[model samples]
Target: MKTEKGFSIADLKMNNRLVLAPMAAISDLPFRLLCRKQGASLCYTEMINAEAVARNNKSAFRLAESHPDDQPLGLQLFGARVESMEAAAKKLAGTEKFDFFDLNMGCPDGRVLRQGAGAALLRRETRACELVKAIKEAGKPVTVKVRLNPNVLNSIRVCKALEKAGVDCITVHGRTVKQKYSGPVDFVSIKRITKAVSIPVIANGNIRSRKDVKITLEKTGAAAVMIGRGAIGNPGIFADLQGHLAIKPINAMFNYLKLFEEFGMDKFGRKKTQVIRFLTKVKKQQVIELVQKAGTEEELEQALAELK
Candidate 1:
């Protein structure tokens, strides 16, 4: 599990342990392709709304789109209602786009919390387990992503219930809802979940570099590490974790632009917004302004070239 060799959970296998966490509005087709090319073993779609999918919403299915090369992907779903979650999974059961379905119980967004989903499920462990069981009825492999409980180390208890509910795997994002994404990942809590559950426990939160991957794997004893914010614009971070040469941010952005355009997803400033996520090193106001005002791939390239 520590090595980058093939890891399997309930018959789902990937060549490596590096996985791209589902980021809303960020893990689209083009972006997932970039990550897959950079060696992410599995790239999950952004959390698809179960309510929307169950309601036959085209936008939800569009968000779950994938390319031919983005194989072995996971379709992540988020919803508080078990009936909607079950219906959504049944609807997507025949799709070849995803290899498995992941339930999102760790998103701390205010809107999601208000709906009694995401990390709100972290506080409602019983309902969370029921959601897992509901999706498993669709006959595809299911996993759950969760966060630690505030003021106590109860993730192990929650994960145990999920394991009993027949979850294929579990991803533990080491921060509670209250902590959100700010504090250090609680490696101790993640380690506990890994030990408590028979299923694979993925360690997430604050994994940005090879060093972070090394330490997290060692301390948490997790089967794999999931990267979210760290991989926003730089997909090569996956390759970097394997001790290979990393693609420069500027270079990655150009490649991203090509993927962006080739996929015909260039409307409504989506391309421009993604281009900005790759500017991890650009600190100048004028260069930032140039990127902000740019309208086309060529202009974005020019703006990035300024940093060189």
Candidate 2:
């Protein structure tokens, strides 16, 4: 199960060290499959609200849905309460749907923090440990994602606690919750945490290119690198890392659209918007304007064909 650039963690075997980070609304079924096809070692579903899943919310269930092709997938759950977290884990375990699970402790959104979830757990170490331990009890391999605490050094302490709670891996986003996504990434603190834990450490944040991936692993000694915004419009970034031909935006867009329709997600306007956002990243201004003006699939396809 081990390759030069890949490793196995519990039951999940990754093909490489590059992972597609869990992104809300952006890491949907079509996008995940696209990234996986492009060589991302693993991909996670957007963070699901534990409370909602515990209540059997249909929308939350849909978010966690996976196909056989989405192997080595991980489901991420977010909640402040041990009861809800445990309940959600149990619910997902019963489905036997995912290769593993991740607990979200790194989200910095105001809405998540206000609910005492996400990055708020960084301040409540005891609660965070309890939540992770509760999920582990579901008998699934679990990982935890976290950001540097107010005191950056505290990341090592938190990571050690998670390891003790039996987390299979740890992904550290190198910015404190307060810093959100701006400013510099704290590679120093990430390296400290990697050294502090026996489990694999996955470094996230500011990873844009293959060189960035190499630099992160070299500097932090992390077992892997997780890319988020960098892969927004460019799943080919993974192919680039694997020394494959860089995929053109038009071709990538065609494949993505085909998969999007195959997944029966065409009714969602937000999904089209997601594709448009990716197009904006790689398309010329005029093409972007045409896509922006597109009101239907035909119009969008016409706009995309111009690039071909």
Candidate 3:
């Protein structure tokens, strides 16, 4: 078997190129660190609202927290306005230690889109170009995550604009706002975008297993792959993609559970059960089903009882 090498967002060679996508509510410090430990070449902070960061919101502070160990971490922010987005980028560049900054143009949530943030910016190509230019001015390797265009012509146009704006790379989530997360990712469209741009393109959307990683790389010709929902609770996928299976699924489960109990509960001030439920939502059933089956509801209750 051939081994796959990794690269940081700076193009620094790494152990693997698998990136953990920034997921809202799930990609906390603990989760991202776990993925790093499990061999992810890169990881990102959860998508933060740029408005919140620009306003100096304390909640935004939590979004950028990281341990010394979590190096090569990317901080992703979402917004539309040039000044607010630029201010947020400046804030991150000022004090927050991060490997890079990512603009979230791919988020399709109605709330975000309606506000002219996230995927809404993709529709406004001129503004998206300017936003990328602002981040580039911040002296960081700027990456942009964009949704696939409802019209392919727009996809190519956005790619051209981002490249011209000097983004280091563009992560194309191969689904449009209208498509949501419905069908299979449109790798063909991603390929077209990749071909249209000079900068690196990281293909994201529905990348689940090791095989899928290789196929996505081949099909889309992206410089790398970013795993999102598929990576939740399955940190070992990072190692698995690299031809190293030193970490087991059970170990990953326990590690994720402990992390959830620690940072998750403390940060949210929620009961352990509530935290456990939220973590489980991102976790696959196969990993948690065994634990759930071994313990009765009461026994499971006892497991989390120690948490609070």
Candidate 4:
């Protein structure tokens, strides 16, 4: 199928304009692969802590891991210090298969904010621009994810600064750091950023359906839409965005479980719990209970088969 106009960052070209947001814990390899299969043009690894990567932390490195099938993936790094961010990016550039790197200035979690790493950068414009410059110097196609600042005008300032720092693209989540995930998304702010920046701008927030995707792209004139919570248990939303029917939850869950095992994720129990919760939103509670009770993957598969 033909895709939206080509989205390129330097020499890298994506198959489509739809991108999967770099969600913490939720955007793991299994979930990314599933989104890719369902039509996500590009996927991002969960936010990686640069300090942990600089320290050679195994867990942090694992978060950035990808397989051959997960091509065109972006590794998002979060850190307040330029040296650590540069060190981590340079090291991963040599060893990782991601096509690009994204600087995380949009995350609003209290932990990230406390470290002055994520949305806190909104207030420290100089430091944020410096970090973008350092990462760009690390020799990779780079992007910055940012949020609308309280002043709104400040968001445009940051986008321009990032572009001047030579970032290839920018993602603008339509809410401020204080709003976090609640309240209405400021699409007008997103539109303003897209108008002010020369590079591609990806619009994120409250994008739950195909109609929402269409409205966002049309209204904001963004290059693409980034799906977060909306894609959790329903990767089929990507297919639906392309005009196909949604994939059955049961079948999608089966595929996710298969990929989960294939990837050999260590936290199967935790992931399984998450899967059950997402499924419960769409599937019967009794069916979810049965799946949860099934201890082994084999048992889980059988239970899913029964649902079919």
Estimate TM-scores for all models: 0.92, 0.93, 0.85, 0.92
lDDT per residue for candidate 3 within 62-153, as digits (tens), equals 78877788878889988888998888889878988887888999888889989898988888989988988887777888888988887888
RMSD each, Å: 2.3, 2.3, 4.4, 2.4
Worst 10 residues of 4 by lDDT: 1-10
Q: On residues 104-128, what C-alpha lDDT tens digit does candidate 4 reach at each position?
A: 9998888989999999998888898
Which residue runs does candidate 4 get wrong by more than 4 Å?
1-3, 287-308
Please give me the total number of clashing residue pairs in predicted model 2: 0
Answer with 2 or 4, whichever has the higher lDDT: 4
lDDT on C-alpha atoms for all candidate structures = 0.84, 0.84, 0.76, 0.85
Please provide, for model 2 over 1-308, each residue's C-alpha lDDT reduced to its tens digit, 9 standing for 90 to 100. Answer: 11147866776778789899999978888888888888888899999999999999978888888899998889999999999899999998897488888989999999999999998888888899899889988888999899998676677777888888788999999998878899988888899898888889888999877678888888888888899998887788878876778676556777878788787664456656776767777756787777778888788778778666
Scored by lDDT, model 4 comes in at: 0.85
| Candidate that scores best on TM-score | 2
Q: Write the per-residue lDDT of candidate 1 for residues 25-95, one digit (tens) a residue.
A: 78888888888888899889989999999999988877877777888888899999999999999988865
Q: What is candidate 3's CA lDDT for residue 58?
A: 82
